[model samples]
Target chain A: MNPEQLNSPNDFQTIVNKIYQNEQFDFVGIALQSSEAPHSIKWDFVAGNTNERFRKIVLRSGIGIAGLVVRTGKPFWDNNLNHYEFSDEMYTPIAKTESLRSAVAIPIISPLTNLVRGVLLAGYRSNKIKISGQTALTLSQYL
Target chain B: MLETTRWINNYFNDSTDAIMIFKDDELILSNQIAKDLQNELELNPQYLVEVADSSVKQKFSPTDNCFSCIIQNKMKEISIPITLAKNMPHPLNYFMIYNVIDQNEKVFSLTLKNRGTIDRMDQLAQQRKLTQYVNRAHEKERKRISEDLHDSIAQGVYSAIMGVRRLENNHFTAEEIKELTTVIESQLNDTLTEVKEMALDIRPSVLDNFGLLAALKVLAKRLEENSGVTINVAGNANTEHLSDDIQSVLYRITQESINNALKHANADEITVLLVAHNHYITLEIMDDGDGFDVPKYQHFNGKSMGLMNMNERVKTFNGAFKMESKSGEGTTITVKFPVA
Candidate 1:
């Protein structure tokens, strides 16, 4: 599996849909940094998103959920968004826009460079889902 | 007699101290100053003698006649010792003139003065200044460690990874040796990545290298990605002209405010704006989330360390901090620093 082949936006969308179907998540998406504007990252592909607002949101390297994964190259998950320690102001924007109640974000690391190339997010809108480390490992296998 | 009375009236009226005349425990005369003093102390002038006598007795000894002894003393100006309530802004000091008008009259002239309050306030201000200094030192250390990690340890790890990768091609001839080298190389790369992340988390190198705006852009971008929250940063302030300390404090305040909003607010969006003008810089963070009770959160014991830390950081540089929020409304934090 060539890294470039997996990097295609369409291929990512297909993968996102598969993850959403397999995991029974309410929302699934992939955000990749633009090559021309490396600092600017956007959700290039999504499946089961509540609205189109997430697609229009342009993220910077350290700004939001996907940006955090991209910035640190680490996976993060919140079993319950409401119970999480993050400020409501930071997550409410996307949580409300997408109606996500719980979520997990995994960074896709490029093996050659050992750098995060994208983030894969899976979540629910109304129900709480405890996305454990095993779930992240399973998702990473697809990448 | 009329002339003497007029002279006493003029003296009582002209005197600045809160003066009251007591003829054998009877409130005979009190000046306007005395009335004003009573009002300020929230006391009743009608019972001034009884109140003072009881308070003095309670402070000294229940059986002692300290108040009467002071009044009976023959000294022209005798000081009456009394203890003020702990919460009172000023300690009460009183002086009495014994037999001022006539030897047989037994009239006592009492004067009240406030001098201890101002001294106590000055002491409190000094303690606050010392606390601010300690906070500044703490922040400085955090910045130093962040810089050290980014400049020294992370860079060293990168070089070591490169060196180890080069060894895999030339030195490891056996297949098993080559495989072991590959495992070691991968572990070292993981350590390098961890070190880099730790450096950024401690303090972003971009903050020191560029300035506040660039640093904020990086923070906002990453926060948005990790939380799926929308954060908009708009500012044209050239932080390069500002001192490193001011820039660091502002960056930290911005970071903490964003973190607070994300973890607690359940908000939809956050907007940060920065402006510099006329030797002053203003930074504002606004969030459209479920706002909190500002006073309650501020006073809530140990629950708002983040807010307190932000306030202390701003105070270190003599900046003004303001936060406004209400339940179901939203929250906004603004800080202003004088660059000049």
Candidate 2:
């Protein structure tokens, strides 16, 4: 994939949708931090959002799962979100809003600055779908 | 004898304390004060035995033998602790004195006085002191914010304005003007950052938008970054159903607890847990730090407003607050609020 293509919102949504379709995940989305407001992160594109709540949320850095990824600049994944003790409070709102059970979040780091600029999250509502850290790293290559 | 009888009646009626006369285990006469006390205490006049059984039965036994002892002039006075009602402000110290009227009827006069009124008054006074401490905390916070604005943003903007006015001068070269503009722009950016920090300190917008859990996560992250203490937040509580007022209260409480742990407790790790149940919500913050003697700071002495503020905030929502700690051991603060 060309680096320039990722700059366009339309192309970004198309790529996210394609990843959701190719991986057969229940949900896939992207949360990008606004350049003007560095503290704000919004779910710019969501492939399987049940409601508009995800779009309305302006996640602060170090807040939700996406915020955690952005703050640490690291990939985060949970095989079963419910079983993850530390992420219980972190994932409830996002999981309930999107009907997700297991999820993975990978920070999209800028090549030049090596700082996290956005997050790519993929998950499933079905309990059988287990997301592993290896799968998150594999998907992160697409970014 | 009629004049003396009238005088005795007036004395009994004018007594401040409740006075009841009993003869042979039956209430024979009660003064106006006694009637008022019965109504105020919500005691049943018909079940005098049950009343005595509930109040004086445990301590003095108000039984037939005791009454006989008093009538026989063996016991001069008997005092027993009596609670008029459950959850009353205080208990009363009931006193019974042996007396004879006209040498025809043997009688016992009962009087009730509140034993814990002084304690209750002391509690009210302490509460007033706590309220004043809370006010001082608010006042200090306001002063800090004002000073931050005046010292940083106000000065930055004043310099920027002076720079713009200087740019109007024709004596300055193009390069000099460009450099001055860059300096002014940087100053403006710094001022904006300072204002944002002040706004966040007052009330983080994320708390209102994303609820308590999100706000707490942000707080934990900030505290960890600043203090180098690792904070792990666990448990899932759906705070979307709660009112904004409740969310704000819980967020502020957690914020204060974390701050106290960072500043006072020399701990390397802190854990915060939030859980929601059928009827209530629970929040626990524990730190592996050197703990202080809890009893020393439990009173309203105006030195430790952090704990007091957290306690008052929890109480405002009718919540239960508890703190457990020991010297050299860790401290844990727990708060529980009923879901409304």
Clashes of each: 43, 0
lDDT score for residue B182 of model 2: 56
A1-143: candidate 2 lDDT, tens digit per residue: 86545777887798798897788788888887665523445678888776665655555444446656765678887666654322233543355456578888888765433456678888888978667778887787778
B207-298 per-residue lDDT for model 1 (tens digits): 88888898899889767755666889998898888988998899889989988887778666899999998889999999998999877665
Model 2 agreement with the true structure over B1-340: per-residue lDDT tens digits: 9999999889989887677777755777888978887888887554544444444343355544655445433344444445666667765554433343333564555665556664678789988887787788789788877876776667768866876887776466675565555545654664675577667778988877887888788778755544446788887898999878888888888888887786677666899999999999999999988998988886556666767767878898899999999988989999999996
Query: Model 2 chain B: which ten-residue window has the lowest total lDDT?
Result: B94-103
Docking class of 2: incorrect
Choose the strongest candidate by TM-score: 1
Interface RMSD of each: 9.3, 12.3
User: Model 1: runs farther than 4 Å from truth?
Assistant: A1-8, A18-23, A30-43, A51-82, A87-121, A126-143, B1-211, B236-244
Measured with C-alpha atoms, the lDDT of residue B125 in candidate 1 is 82
Q: Which residue pairs clash in candidate 2?
A: none
Local accuracy of candidate 1 as per-residue lDDT tens digits, A57-129:
6554443455467556798776666543443213433544576777778997655445665788887876645
RMSD of candidates 1 onward, in order: 12.4, 17.1
